[model samples]
Target: MTTSATRQQITGARSIVVKIGSSALTELTTGLDVRRLDALADAIEARMRAGSDVIVVSSGAIGAGIAPLGLKARPKDLATKQAAASVGQLALAHAWNTSFARYDRTVGQVLLTAHDVSLRAHHANAQRTLDRLRSLGAVAIVNENDTVATNEIRFGDNDRLAALVAHLAGADALVLLSDVDGLYDGDPRKGDATLIPEVGGPEDLDGVIAGSGGALGTGGMASKLSAARLAADAGLPVLLAAAADASAALTDASVGTAFAPRPQRLSARKFWVRHAAEATGRLILDDGAIRAVAGARHSLLAAGIVATKGRFYNGDVVDLADQKGQTRARGVVGYDAGEVAQMIGKSTGDLPADFRRPVVHADDLVAL
Candidate 1:
């Protein structure tokens, strides 16, 4: 695990992804806070002018919608929340569009649903669009397609999406701007807590207590940390800072909790499979299978699989876990769950001719 000294590498990254949570975006009870949004745009434009391709991942559709719908607080039920998002997404995007226009910068709104983000083909399409947007000198303003998404509107926030976007855009660094300044040793509301300047790995976060989301945002500090760690593991350094310090955080490395990236970066495809492709099923492997798949880095054999879980189709991502239920790797299953169930524990030579191949090819798998 490296220390904050690695911040030097992120000082002037040519490409970066900056994410602002709903809490920061909707500090005003009325709706989208224009002043804060404008400040953010100013900071982003400055970076773009300095020769960096900046992509913004924003989370405020639900929060911005609360005021417009006459709701006194965030909606509780899924339908009401989606309604708010339906009304709010427009307000949020329009605000973003107009905010960047002040500096004559074009902002392209890109909304992604969970399926659009996780599937292989859809993920590739999004990656291309973001890359092309950067090349055309436009900022990509990404947000969840909340109105149509089922699960995402609840537990999944834009922080995780930002982590995924960082790699999709091939960003050199990621900056997470939220209400809080940075990671703290304890609950930040308490006077005795101290801000943590850097996080090397899980060991450094042993006793940290990251609370849940606020009334306006779906993600809290816990989600931000999860997202930051996700990006760091994919070999992208991340800086978690306060939305008020947006300019300083982007221009320098001293304002926030800087997380060091892994020494080696996984190939873009592998990284996508590991993080973005949400697993649709699980295949339980025996001890020998775990050793071969995780330790030796070999293709998964149907003979090694002892059990299967979930209803997944062929070519869908699935977790390859051990009997102890620990997922050792994620891979694109070669067959449907029902089909895979029939071949479990059967050696290739002894199995039916049509089911003789590896259950998961090494080329389509990533060890966790």
Candidate 2:
């Protein structure tokens, strides 16, 4: 694990993604916080002027809608929440537009759903659109498509969406601006708690208590950590900081937790195949199959599969299970469930004349 001071030394990041939570966007008394919004826009414009590309993933549509709709608090039901989002999204964009107008910079709204990235074609298109927007010198503000997304279809929070956006935009770094300063070893409210500056890998924070943020924000420390993992896996460094300290964090002032990127970067296709896609079925494999698929990095073969679970079509994502029923990996299966069932336990050479391709190609598999 690296210390906070060490992480703060990372500078000169060319492209960055900054995510701000709803709590940081709204006023405590009523309506939106114009000062903070303006300050954030100014900071982003400064970065852009300094030759860095900046993308802002902002959350506040529901919070901003509360005052307009006369709602006392955030609505619990999904329908009401969506209604708030619909009303608030307009206000949110208007706020950014107004703020950025001071510097004569234009802002573009990009709403997305998890499914947008789940499919390969949609993901590629989204990436291209965002890249084009940045190249045109416009600030791209992204938010989840809350108006139409159900609980099952939602990205859950903006943290995950920001990480995904970072990957899509090929950002050099991700800055998650929230209410808290950074991740801590213990809850910050506790007297003995201390900030955690750098996370080398998953094992560093074994028993850290990641407490909930506040009522206005859906994500907590846990979600931010998960976001860090996602960005890190994609080889993008992540900086977790307070929304108030966005400028300092962007300047590498060591005001937040920094999750360093892994040395190896996964291909965009593999990243989408592994993390973005939802698995539709499971295939149980023997020990030999696990070693061949995971250890040797070979494609799954019908002979190694012992059992199949769930109904999945060809090209659907499926989990590879071991003999004990534990999932060892996930991949897109080349054959449908019915076809795989007929070919299971049969040697590659013994397969029926029409079934000869690899069960799950190496290009599709992602080790869990």
Candidate 3:
């Protein structure tokens, strides 16, 4: 289906990614909930049997490890958290394997770090692996590589990771399962809350205040909304619903809130530059450059650069700032800081042969 497909079109999606939150899969006092796992497996298997490829992004490693490690609550320290993930990952994988085996279907486990999705080569490798697994008739179950990921490399929450995975796998739609049914105009806990049936873009969440999920989960409504936005920006439609409604959400159009995908599909490199990559330095630009890049969608030339701030190498992402220091865009620079310094105020034609082109090509740039 195309990016503009309606929620009714979800049932015909060729490929789908489902993300389940920790709160939906595990209990606070108990660990992994077997009934819930079985239900989710059934839902996924049904979709797969209907001729659509399904990928599951699940969270519950730390929650499952809590009881086995004799911890009274979720660990606060990073070391304990890593230890819990180490102990729980096996259990998590086994539960999924056992559940899927009831249908004689095999499941493959995939663990990823932030770098895996942000770096070009690593991203392509991950996409190839997932594509291969799907072709082999095995449903790929993905989770963050929490055991080895440092704080700097973590995706913060699996919501964002799931969004990136949806993009990488070229999923036609994304389903996020949580405790609540969908986004609300106000806190559902408080009286008189209403479910938001659809969100066209960020402006739909203008005055909405989103709080945290329960103790067992890391993401709240805000995280899920952000994830939905990311996936939608990449031209993937999204549906948010309660975990118990997985079967219906996959087959029915009106079960949950749906977010419409953007009309234009962003290239993989542009998506990464816009959402995942870390900027290395800043390039100060003049008013003419800002208007050209943001308004006219033009490439950034050396003539428009007033100054360069911080060190960066060729092919590294850098912030494109206006004279007032506000970052207007981000792009992959063609030259390092030193090379840029030599041609700062010169036109492309006036520069040496080595520097006779745009500093940051339009294709590599994303307007902020």
Evaluated with lDDT, which candidate comes out highest? Answer: 3
Q: What ranges in model 3 sit over 4 Å off?
A: 1-5
- lDDT, each prediction: 0.88, 0.85, 0.88
TM-score against native, each model: 0.94, 0.95, 0.96
Task: Arrange candidates, best TM-score first.
Answer: 3, 2, 1
Q: Which candidate gets the maximum TM-score versus the true structure?
A: 3
Estimate, for each residue in 143-192, the C-alpha lDDT of model 1 and write its tens digit.
99888889643238899999988998789999999999999989979778
Q: Clashing residue pairs in candidate 2, if any?
A: none
The C-alpha local distance difference test score for the whole of candidate 2 amounts to 0.85
**Runs off by more than 4 Å, candidate 1:** 1-5, 152-155, 352-354
lDDT of 3 at 5: 47
Clashes of each: 0, 0, 0
Residues 100-139 of candidate 3: C-alpha lDDT, one tens digit per residue: 9999999999999898877778888999999999999998
Model 3: how far is 161 from its true place, Å?
0.6
Model 1 worst lDDT window (10 residues): 1-10
TM-score comparison, 2 vs 3, better candidate:
3
